[model samples]
Target: MSSPQFSFATTAEEVATAFSNEIKGKNVLITGTSLNGIGSETARVIAKHANLVVVTGYNEARLKATEDALKKENSSANIRRLVLDLSSLAAVRKAAAEVNSYSEPIHVLIHNAAAAIGPLNLTVDNLDSQLATAHIGPFLFTKLISPKLLAAGTSGYVPRVVWVSSGAHAFATGIDFDALRKPNKEGYQAMVAYAQAKSANVLMGIEISKRSKGRVNGYSLHPGVIYTNMNQKPESIAEMQAIGILDADGKPSTEKFEWKSIPQGAATTVAAAFDPSLNATPGAYLDDSTLANDKVGAHCLDAANAKKLWEVTEEIVGEEWVF
Candidate 1:
């Protein structure tokens, strides 16, 4: 399929406006919507079009703040808050159940939250912290809410699951199944673990697209290199420099990088979720608001690996989520 002719400079608000008629009255659920983050911006833009916008975060204070910000943007906006801590499997499941209890079909599910450059650690579930927070928790949450997404299809809406993957997936060797199953401090490399989780996110989208068979569309995207709270911390900045994402002076490298504004970073995600051109192309990898033909690595597009990831994720989550 030919890539869409979208300007790389487009912002989330523009994308949302372009599709406002189509997405009006739709219900959207977005994760990791803390203040001043891409997810928050995405949710804000989406609220302009969607009937109900649910923003979630681990911190109650931040979640409330985000809801308040959205309300401020549009006082009449129907916004809800879900307290979700992706680091815990139990919390993810409970949150998913709460979303389900709303009795409203979910038209779009955006897995926009992620943990980056954090210390090596294990969750109570014994899974790698990065993997659990970034992939596993979102994977399970998606599974539980899929029925709602599928039901929305009956109304002629093209329900979507948007996985916010990163270009960093290109740096990962592959999924270390053993390490994910039993992560030890000695075996953990923070960036590598994060890369693996990002790769898994892409694979999860591919697998979900296959299983849903058109009832629900899935897409993964690299929301360009943006300076957000997730990657702007001192530790995260040091790691970015080490990985050549930034320069010694703490600025993005001009030669190979162009940092995106928060809204700009969210353009591709908004495009993937509502672009009519993508209706026939589920499981595509998008970057810079267009289909990325070659930038997505072979590993991320591996079907067999995607299936394996689906299976392993089910096992880790201790639930059979048949689509």
Candidate 2:
């Protein structure tokens, strides 16, 4: 399939304009939409086009701030906010049920929420925090809301689920299911755990596309190495400074690398969610606002691994999502 006309330089707002006519009455949902992150920016642009836009995050203040900001930016924008902590299964279930209660079928679901480079820990559900937040929680939420997506498809809307993965998935050799199932502090590393979770995100996209059998499309993408709050921890800043990625004042060192602007970073996500060219090619991995030619990783593309991960995820979430 041919890629969309968009390129790496395309901004989220431009992508929205390109699809505004078609998306005017669509229902879109996005997670992890804090004030200035990619999720929020994507939602901001989509809100201008979509009939209803649902923004979600774990922080109440940030969620409200985003909601207010979106309304402030476009007074006529139809927007809603919901609390969704991807680390908590209970919270995910409640949020999914609440979203399901809405009369409109969801036309697009963007899994833009993720936990990266956080301390190794376990959630109340006994799963690794990074894995739970980045994969398991979203997995359960997607399964719960899939019926809505299918319904939207039946009604002539192209329903899509976009997973915001990272190129970091290439850093991990493969997913250590045993370690993820029972984390051990002796060998835990934040980035490695994050990479594993990201690989799982890609695998979930592949599996969902296969399971949905074209009723709903699934996509995963590397949103580029944009500077975001998730990577602005004191430790992270110090590490980046050491590597010359950031300076002492916590700004990008342009000579070393050019970090993507927020809109540029969100362009691919916006494209993945609404690009008509991708409707025929579900489960595609995208980067720089285009379909990635290189493999994300061997394990990420393994059908057997994707199926196993899906089964284990269902067991961990304590729910069976029969498609």
Candidate 3:
């Protein structure tokens, strides 16, 4: 089968309008919008088409700013902001509860928030900060939201969730079940952990799609490298630069590689979230808006491993998954 060619020269608003039309009356709860980052831009784009836009982030001020911006553009659309810190399970549960309290069914969820912890660092959960923010936190959040999504799907909402994964996910070996902490012995190892988390995201998304059959469509997409704030922090941006990950231009050198302008970076995600053709093709890894069948992203293709990761994540969260 031919893979989908995911490039788009269109503007972000055009992509947003196209995607929003797919779920015009559906509720969309987008996380990580409180920060001045890609998530905010993504939310703004979605707000243009979605009936209700729920924005969330850890910073109250940034969240408010995002909310105000969305409302300014679409005064009549229902928009709300909730401060959420995905690093803590408590916060994840609370946010999930709040989202579930809504009477409307949620149609889409985009997991775009991630932290790149370069130096060896641990969260309060004794997990690597990158792993916590990128993998564990989002994993738990998905678990918490599964019931609502399942309900929505059963209610004829055709609920869907999109995990904003990355091509760097190809670099990881797989999840380490024994060492859930993934302690980094070297600086380079930290980058490996980040890849592991990203790979896990793709796997988890695939698993959700497989498990749901055609009921709830879940997908993981690699938005081509766009310059984003997740790379701004020292531990992240500096480390990548130190390792020659960036070109002399000081930006992520996607010239020799592949990079997307913001709109192009958002293309695959929009396609996965809205394309009518993909409504039946569940559990597929999408790179640039097409199914990835090559060894290019093999780590995310392990169905058994994905099931294990799902089971372990559920055990850690101490809750039963709804879907």
Best by TM-score: 1
lDDT of 1 by residue, 21-61 (tens): 76798999999899889999999999987899999999999
Q: Least lDDT summed over 10 consecutive residues: which range in candidate 1?
A: 1-10
The prediction achieving the highest lDDT against the true structure is 1
Runs off by more than 4 Å, candidate 3:
1-11, 34-36, 154-157, 181-188
| Candidate 2 residue lDDT tens string, 1-107 | 45447776889998888877767888999999986689999999999989999999989999999999999999999999989999999999999999889899999
Alpha-carbon lDDT, every model: 0.85, 0.85, 0.72
| Estimated TM-score for each candidate | 0.95, 0.94, 0.89
Candidate 1 residue runs with Cα over 4 Å from true position: 1-4, 248-255
Candidates 1 and 2, the one with greater lDDT: 1
For model 3, name the residue pairs that clash: 4-290
Compose the digit string of candidate 3's lDDT tens values, residues 216-245: 787787777677667666667766676566
Which order, best to worst by lDDT? 1, 2, 3
Model 1 has an lDDT value of 0.85
Inter-residue clash pairs, candidate 1: none
